[model samples]
Target chain A: MTTVLIVDDQPLQRYGFRMLLDSVPGTEVVGEAAHGAEAVRMAAQMRPDVVLMDVRMPGMDGIEATRRIVAAGDRSRVLVLTTFDIDEYVYAALRAGASGFLLKDARPEELLAGIRAVAAGDAVIAPTLTRRLLQEFARLVPPAADGSAQDSRLASLTEREREILVAIGKGWSNSEIAGHFVLAESTVKTHVGRVLSKIEARDRIQAVIFAYDHGLARPHAG
Target chain B: MTTVLIVDDQPLQRYGFRMLLDSVPGTEVVGEAAHGAEAVRMAAQMRPDVVLMDVRMPGMDGIEATRRIVAAGDRSRVLVLTTFDIDEYVYAALRAGASGFLLKDARPEELLAGIRAVAAGDAVIAPTLTRRLLQEFARLVPPAADGSAQDSRLASLTEREREILVAIGKGWSNSEIAGHFVLAESTVKTHVGRVLSKIEARDRIQAVIFAYDHGLARPHAG
Candidate 1:
């Protein structure tokens, strides 16, 4: 069952979430908190699978709470709650390590689905929305000042390894990459590990980020 | 009825799209082009509501075509088609000013839905995929070398204006920002306009990008 901690300042909102989530199969409301501070503490104590985070909180606000919870290093992923899909809260939450978000007005099924998706270690925002959000952010991104230095680091990667990094940045699964490139899955994994080490990335996600930050991968320009 | 220009090198692919789109009510297949060059010319000449562009054309390719189409200042929105959802081609397409994209294997209904969404000026990628793709790209981005100078532009703005810039960078819509700041929507609109001019951003999207590019906005760290 997916365990959730509902974090909302509004008691009614919290109660509504609890009532709805408690009824869903394969899901459980582990706890609820009225503000970001309480949510952070409860998240650590409860270690729930997902935190239904409300962005505009009373004491600390959901962004900081999300940052702290993520920094604390637990398996709990944050699914931020926002008043509007296009709110600044959602973007702040994402940067704060939120796995996903949903509008407060989302139907019960969508809320449950978002929770489950975050719990499954998959991001929740649709790619279209994600692109608009990211593209907007990316536009202000000037080429990394230290890009030349980063580019040199990539110079060590073999062509195949570079190709794998591009694939990873494209959000391809290892199996998908392996199939597309006609490489053994084990071989792809080995390449991935080597690519990570060579680039000094924490993992595949970091590696993908590294590719984009360094201009090795770029969103297609229209 | 929404008019469309189908651009794909493959005869069968173009024919398949034509048949499907022609059968759909309120969607007219205005014209067809077998290559990027033709597609660009047709987009300018016909000015269709949407351009169903295939990415891997032999002559010019969809990315360049999309860039040209958008650069020409026409009203047609480019909806790129690709073999893989995660292909760098899609990212490049977005950067090139394509409204959105679809995988070649998308269901007929999904394709229709996507076209309609694009025609309505909405992005069409799934939000989850978008986050992953954008997040990966965002991570690799380096601090802009000229950021200190660009930041000085933000320095001229009042504290409230700066806050609005952050909100814009986070992809908050105008009404959402107004609601968050508890300010009148008209006041928020004024602030947004000032923020845009002060930052030298062409539009809200550019302002959002500029915020991140200049470190005014950043994803939370874990």
Candidate 2:
């Protein structure tokens, strides 16, 4: 069962969340806190799978609490809840290491789905906020500079492996890469494995991020 | 009714889309384009509400077509489709100003929903891509740089409205801000509206972005 710690200053809000979570299968309310400090302390002690955080709490606010919980490096993932669709703290919370955030009024299923996603080590964001986030993200991330000559992380890749890395960055599956490069899917997988090991990426997602960071995955101007 | 233009090189693929869209209510297939150049020309001529674009077409690709269409400043919103979840071109398409994108294998209902969202002037991204996008976004966007001293935008905001801008950046609702500052919620809304106008932000989301852009919204280290 996935365990959760609910953090909110409003008792009624906490009670409402507790009721909903309790009604669901495979999810249990492990603890509840009325403020950030209590939430942080409980999270450390309880070590729940998900921390349902309220952003505008008393004492330490949710953003700072999320940072501390993540920095403490326990298994808990903070899923912030905000009253507004365009809350400013949500961005700070994300940068502060929050796994995700959702609208406080999100459908119960959406909240449950978010909790499940976060507990499984995936991140989630409210749909309403995502478009603006993407736009801001594209605007803020400068186009990658040519890094093949300078970044050593890319130095270990073979020319073929490097090509595979680029394909991975492009979100190509092994079969797609194989089709594009005229290789067997098995061979494509082997190349992907090798590339991941050489680049020290735990998974394809990190490798994609690495490719972008190193200029291997350039965003072409349309 | 939402009018759509389907652009794909594969005749069968176009036929499949045409059938599905035809079967759905509240949507009509207005035209079809076999290639990027055709897609652009058709988009300019027909002005459909949505363009269901495939990214890998020969000649002018979907990204280029999307860019040209967006540059033309028509009402059409391009929703790019890709075979893979993490298509590299998807990012470029977003940068190119497509309203959103989806996996080609997405459920028919999901595709219809995406079209509706795009036509309504909202942006959509495949849910699976959002986590990595947000992570990359957070990493790419630098923390606010304390711009109160230099930015002409900040000069226009009164001290109270400036506080409201920062609060908005934190994603506080009018009620939340009112509670925090002991003001009426309507008064908070008025201040927020003023802040948006003073800084020339179209809405709260843009205001949040502006706050981040100008360093009024700082991401604290966790």
Give one digit per residue, the lDDT tens place, for model 1 in B1-222.
899999999999999999999897999999999999999999999999999999888989888898899989888998988886754665567667778767888789879988997888777664445556546543544333221123568679899888998887665777888889999999999999999899887667556556655666554311
The fnat of each candidate, in order, is: 0.11, 0.20
The sequence of per-residue lDDT tens digits that candidate 2 reaches over residues A116-215 is 9889887877767766776775555434421112456687889999999989867677788999999999999999999989989866755765665565
Best by lDDT: 2
Tens digit of lDDT per residue, candidate 1, span A70-185? Answer: 88999889888788666455556666778886677776776787788789887676433544664664353433421112456687899999999888866677898999999999
TM-score of 2: 0.63
**Each prediction's Cα lDDT score?**
0.76, 0.81
**Tens digit of per-residue lDDT, candidate 2, span B8-46:** 999999999999999989999999999999999999999
Quick one: best DockQ, which candidate? 2
Displacement of residue A124 (Cα, Å) in model 1 is: 3.5
Error of 1 at A31 (Å): 2.9
TM-score of chain A of each: 0.61, 0.65
